[model samples]
Target: VNYILIDKFQEKFGSAIQNLSESSVISLELNGINISRFGKLCWLQVSTKETVYLFDILTLGYEAFDFGLRRILENEAILKVVHDCRFLSDCLYHQYKTSLANVFDTQIADVIVRKEEAGGKWPDKLRLLPECLSHHLGLPAAAFQKYSVSRQPLEQASATVWTMRPSHSALLHLAARHMPELLALRTVLLDKLMVPFTIHVGHSLDAYR
Candidate 1:
């Protein structure tokens, strides 16, 4: 689960993500800070079952809205696996007026699987990314908890600090593991699912329809 850093987004990200579209399936993880109700998409992490690519979206600026990136997102041929893509999808639509296609949200799918396992009864509780991974993939809770810590207290600084930090920095190390962990989780969870999954029509919570 080694990662590649795409610091020069305008020059390399478009081509990098475009080439990713050639794969049959892509697992994507995005992290951003909320700025005035809109997501300031700062980082985009992608994995193709083999390699992980981390893009510093802040480096791209408006150029992050490149047509190549849009094509990959909107392409029905490439299945995109994500967890809780609602806000991420909204942010993309806000930035470029485009929506994601061929998406399978693991969070939504987990709900459906859990419900099926409960024999149509409501599960007592539903879990978020960390808990879900711990249950299905045996990921250590401590590893996930470390992601919440920042070497520098980001609460007092701009969210752009995530992008400015070096790869060796504590924050970057924790944040970058998201995509690799997600890629592994997808395979493990799908095998343990008790029910068939339905592709969600949009960024809605209820995927049962």
Candidate 2:
């Protein structure tokens, strides 16, 4: 995992953005106080299969997006796997004037999977990231203890904790952990979706025969 602050702005972050642009698919996670249109968006975690980058929105500000990140996020050719993009989308569009494109939202996918499993009834409630991780990845609680523990302290702390400069290790750890799990969850959900999709297509083909 790499932390991209003002010191590493030009070289490190620029290279990361370039690499993200080149990749066909990547996972994204955003952290902030509230993370809605009116709230602060402090850190952005972008991950490929190999590397994770934590971009410090507090330190680098809009330059972080303008430098190259915006292009990648808006680029339709690049697929971004994220969990529940509503708030992320709101924050980006309202604050940064950036519209996300080609996004695969895992939360929505999970809902669709559940709806299919229930014979087309929509789920009553949306699943959070941990639940999605457990349900899709088949990971036990012990497997994700580190991630859970890392997030709990922040949840109890003040919202301004995200806006704090020189972020704490716990916050950084939480940011670093989400992308890999999200990428894994995407793989599992995609596989699950295909089973139903394939069956539906096969039935449609039978109608022609």
| Top of the candidates by TM-score | 2
lDDT of each: 0.69, 0.84
**Could you give candidate 2's per-residue lDDT for residues 1-209 as a string of tens digits?**
45443325767877888889899989998888888798888888889988888888878888877888899999999999998899899999999888999999999999999999999999999998888998888889876787676665654465678788777776787678768778889999999989887999999999989
lDDT (Cα, tens digit) per residue for candidate 1, span 83-133: 888777887787766688898788877777787777777677656677777
Please provide TM-scores, in order, for all candidate models, with all chains considered together.
Answer: 0.77, 0.90
